[model samples]
Target: MNTSPTNSDSDTLRVLAQAIAKLILRFRFSRSRFLTLLDEELVLQAKNNDPQANNVTLSIRTGINRRYIPQLLSGEAMHSKPERLKMILEDLKWTSQKHYQSGKVPLKGSFNTFETICELRASGTLTYKAILEELMKQGKVKVAGNKVEIISNNSEQDNEHREFARNSVEKVFYTVEEIIQTEKN
Candidate 1:
């Protein structure tokens, strides 16, 4: 039995690593933090496979310090900003239902308005500009002369934008599945 990984295995690993790197960068995860989380996941898998497995075994297998394993396992990581952005968009959509007039809303006001809706959706965690930027980037909203028009709810109306959104969501799902499968082993 050949113990070494084949070329196909190496290529697959490289692609997986690239995907993980993108996720880490997009989510602003620090390398050390990701490594710690990975170590914790490895420990969990080890324990699942063999109930007698301990931190020392995990450290030996994952090359992470045994001292840090428990801390890593106990700490809860924050949810991804993109997921939060989706929630914010949903909140914006709900708020827009009441305020939308002729498919557009004035971007001026402190209450019950488009600007206020964005702020309320952000809940102070994201700046108004940041929220608008994300919405505009996704082609979900368009700004023109002090009016923000609802171009498409979640970019459903525009085929190009819809495809982009679909690809993005698919990437998130793929990454999640990959992580789960990795942990299972």
Candidate 2:
């Protein structure tokens, strides 16, 4: 019994130590990769039409310094205690592949759970009293609870709403422009 306990203790300690080492190595590599990605994003953004481009843009945009960049990219900074560099390289490769793989954005329709619940009620899925009872049972639509958290549409108006407003403004502006052009003629 004593010998078994000793072996178990040793095994537990070994597992814990391995987990800690792995976590440390992962953090070191993740931070380094994060810096590299930051630099690349900065360079790309600097080339784009954004007006804010300065010397510190390399550091500010990439969130990394030139001095650290070489150390990180070379894999020297991560230091091969074991599979640290390999893991980071694998992660970066996957990310690169994902970036290169182009696909059309999937179309999405309007989804409102609140509206669905109302429609279900109208269709006699349950009576209003039955719905209230279900809500009380679930604790989500709490009645007696000290704090009743209501699910509300807190999200801002969707793109469709913005598009409608934009089109309305454009139509008005174009009409005014046409009138001006006609008067000038």
Candidate 3:
């Protein structure tokens, strides 16, 4: 009759749940979105064991309802912020190089300036303004009267920070390599 998780198992689950909870809160991710992504990931894992995995099998393995599986996996996967920031910097670097004398791009544009770069590089779920604001807040960019200037690569410390962010993004989004391989095949 005693079917609850054992003390050690419960503690382990609690620690993992707590860490995930903190990550969600720190990143301002919605609870429902997180749940959906968790379900999608579980379903993916289930498929690894049984290639012909179905909703019922996924639900049983993941302990999530079969009904929610479809809806949860319908949305696109999210790319982490550090990855987007790195991309923005890359695009900005190009723009800076193209306009070497100025070293800045116009902040305003419908499809040509920083806006277009953000749209192409960052997640569509994020607004154009939100991405720009985050970059500005991180001191990776500065705003002029009508342009945004990248504030990087002038010193060793800035390069170190960029390297650190690149590494963090690669670690957190390592699954991207798997997704790419699957898509290719």
Which has the greatest TM-score? 3
Please report the candidate that would top lDDT against the real structure: 3
- Candidate 1 residue lDDT tens string, 156-177: 4456654665677488768768
Summarize candidate 3's per-residue lDDT along 64-94 as a digit string, tens digits.
8787766545645544344566777788888
Cα RMSD to native, each candidate?
9.2, 26.5, 11.1
Instruction: Please estimate how well model 2 matches the true structure, expressed as its whole-model Cα lDDT.
Output: 0.43
Each model's lDDT comes to 0.68, 0.43, 0.71
**lDDT winner, 1 or 2:** 1
Candidate 2 lDDT at 62 equals 59
Off by over 4 Å in 2: 1-151, 154-157
Error of 2 at 123 (Å): 45
Better of 2 and 3 by TM-score: 3
RMSD of 3: 11.1
Instruction: For model 2, give the 10-residue run with minimal summed lDDT.
Output: 102-111
